[model samples]
Target chain A: MKDRITGLFYILAVILLTTIHSIELYIGFFVLLSVLSGKDFIPVMKKTFVAVALFNGVITLAYILIKGFDYGYIALINLRVIDMTFMTFLFVRRVNLFRLFEFSSILTYLLVISYSQILLFKRYYTEFILALKSRSIKTPGLAERYGFLRSATGFFIEKSVKNSSEISLAMKSRGFFMD
Target chain B: MIELKDVSFSYQGRKAVENITFSVQKGEKVVILGINGSGKSTILKIINALLFPQEGTYRYRGEIITPKKMKDREFVRKFRKEVVLLFQNPDTMIFNPTVFDEIAFGLRQLGEKDIKEKVHYWADKLGIFHLLDRSPFELSGGEKQKVCLAALLSLEPEVLLLDEPTANLDPRSTGWLIDFLYQLDITVVTTTHNLGIALELGERGLVLSENHRLIYDGNLSEFLKDREKLLEANLIHIHRHRHDDMEHRHYHIHDDFS
Candidate 1:
């Protein structure tokens, strides 16, 4: 499917799944979508299941204590949430976000920038952690931990500001604001 | 044409560049050579109008480029369209999903017709045509640099400002870029800590001291031959070594220290 069409379909599916109260229908739809999505379905379903179980477990327990064991309502709510989450994962995996938002160039640009920045942040964080691990011969003490945290926070803040400014200039140099 | 007179800039009360004066005629190529943190990139930013000089004037053609002048949409549009800067980090410069889209970005922003053709042309020129459909984030540093170069070059800007273009590139890619840049007829100003690239990029060189002063501006060949000037700029260090067979004297760059 075209990315834009897939995005639109995903949105519609989310709305439909949320409104529908039938646990059987939601389960049927989830199974169908899972099968259609192929290889990524299992992992997506696993993640959605864990997330939904943890979140709804608390709420479902409280409800059961207050009222009674309502298997139908609890099952329906949990299934709906799982279906929505799975659909979102499927959409993300299927669609090329940059291409999906190409209709709005500015939006596409912003998405690309944000995505790159997120990757950069992740890389920086990982490097810091790795460096800390490599340098330490023993467990870090309280003072050492505090120092590392302070330094890491300062570095992250400075890097974020620097990256944003530099990226902004790069965009401007390319006539990104000309339109 | 571009000119800067008595230009100075500071970041958080710390000076980056000071009392800088230089000019480039139409179609002239100039290389700014300096050690790291010597404000070479800062000068490029000022030229691109990305940063306003805190003192003195920066002019393109004849008119002064002030913050007020840049506020004028028309002036900014014209300036941005005419002068383009390739940042030091290609990773920061690339923010598109695919190499093709990244190269086509500037053309699209400028409302250029036949963006595909321009993108393909530059991509082919840069030898990144095969990677066109691939994600820029997945590319190697050299490939990313080529993609960024293609993107900026596709716009056909009159003035090209490159900040440490060869910094992250491998030797082969660096050679390719040098060869490619040597053929361009545009007004080019590039910054580099590598004296070799500076020498290759242009005959004229501007050396910024560690303290952010313009210490040298003239023939690059002459400037490079002067060991004192090079040492003063912190570009190299003289090291003496003795082997079992013989003694040798050489100058080596302290890359990490710099």
Candidate 2:
């Protein structure tokens, strides 16, 4: 379960789902996935739909605007996207993703750094919002809101640049860039 | 005045504080001490209403402070003007264009007419008047902190909640802040891991253990004298030192705060 077999299995499933063109086959696959999801069927399906809704909505709208509406085509495309996303979610939930990537040191390093940066940014974002909330007796006006947004954007951009350089130096000290 | 009755909170499933209970009275200076990750900041956030306890009640001035209660506009207006928190990082609080605007932000938002007077007053008090025209982002860490404190204090809050107020300060700046706070009559609760400077910040101390429970709540100096409590909190550890040209191990509290 921790080896590349799990990764390969998901990759092959994705390829099959992508290459298939038959609507009936997609429906059948979706049903089978629902059965395999067990108690997670509803939650996974909800998350999968939510995840694909915006992208699917935009693309479907663009497709209609460019040409015309095709009901069967829309159903087939939406089904495929939902199924793929659902499978991916299930894969992440069930597998130890770090173990699957243990074969690649560079990947592990990138994952670690990205995870750390995400947590750091999340903390900073909360702090920014809370600081604003604690200081305000009334709702911020539009001009003040714009000021806060600009300042927050500037802060994040500065943080991103500084963190990247620091990470680059740390990686260099470890000789990670040796060619 | 603030009271937490068996307050407990967790982030997701991981507990940050477990059934922690304590109270602070009017015009009292209290310091919360713990090693890093011991929930010192979490308690401050609770007091500042940034986070709420999942288990028990938090009462401020005899009114149960809940999200619903806070939604009342009048209550919010009163609470916002009465309680203020200086975040651990000044950068998070420094979003205004200029130092002057930064100090006047809260006052302006509250529709106060004398924004100029209050901003100038606090800016002069914090000694950031020279940087009034400059952007807050351009200032040094200590200067940025002063700007933020001035902003929070401009509202004339009754309770000041400071989270590691001197974490980024130098010796001189820290001394200045300590002296200024000592003179301020507002009730203050400050969080810090610096055991050496903890007593200077407050007469009463609340110590949080590694498990995120309040292990000691009493006189500040008495808590410092209790070796077992300090050891339990992991504030003091065994140190290997040289005595009379002979090496020996002794219990010591790290003095890196100075």
Model 1 chain B: lowest-lDDT 10 consecutive positions? B88-97
Each prediction's TM-score against the native?
A: 0.59, 0.88
lDDT of 2 by residue, A92-155 (tens): 7777777888888989889889889999999999999998888878888888889889999999
Q: List ranges where model 1 is wrong by over 4 Å.
A: A1-179, B245-258
lDDT of 1 at A131: 37
- Model 1, span B81-165: residue lDDT tens: 6888887666555545678877876676567899999998999999999999998877888888888788878878899998888
Top lDDT hit: 2
What TM-score would candidate 2 get against the native?
A: 0.88
Real A-B contacts recovered, model 2: 0.78
The prediction achieving the highest TM-score against the true structure is 2
Residue B216 error, candidate 1, Å: 0.8
Worst 10 residues of 2 chain A by lDDT: A1-10
TM-score of chain A of each: 0.68, 0.76
